[model samples]
Target: MLADYIHFMKDDFWFIVPALWFIGYACKRTPFIPDWLIVWILLCIGVLASCFFYGWSVRAIADGVIATGIAVFSHQIVKQTSARDQIE
Candidate 1:
């Protein structure tokens, strides 16, 4: 059973690589947008990634990583924005 699942993932590894990379890039480019918007965008990405990769299943690890990435990305934006606001 586990081997079957592993095989499925191996076949889809190519798709997952690009998807994860794009998520990282989007997080990096969050400065041009609002914090709330970034949160929503990340949530959408998480949902889509879950649906695509897991179908009707739940993925704790993937979801956690996605949420953590969004939180870290948004934290940096908030820090930079606060600094800019203080300067102004």
Candidate 2:
């Protein structure tokens, strides 16, 4: 299971993950857009961008969603941990 995940990360999701992270982080800084809308827009961009590589297949879309989720999860982990540490 671990190997499979590593393979997926190396072959499919490496670039998309970081790119989406940066996009989301940048979007979060914009005050004009509501926070709720930022994530949805970022996910859509990730999915659409993946289509360029996978040519509109289900796999492409799935990979995009997974990558985006991973990026968001990682961001939240860092954010929450840092906040908790600061409180101490």
List TM-score per model, in order.
Answer: 0.37, 0.81
| Candidate 2 per-residue C-alpha lDDT over 1-88 given as tens digits, one digit per residue, 9 for 90 to 100 | 2244545533755788788888887888988888888778878987887878778988888777767767777788789978996877
TM-score of predicted structure 2 = 0.81
* Count of clashes, each model: 0, 0
**lDDT tens digits, residue span 1-88, model 1:** 2233343332443344345446656766778776456555655665566566656455633553454454445556667978996876
Residue 69 displacement in candidate 2 (angstroms)? 0.3
Runs of candidate 1 with Cα error greater than 4 angstroms are: 1-33, 60-88
- Show pairs that collide, candidate 2: none
- lDDT score of model 2? 0.76
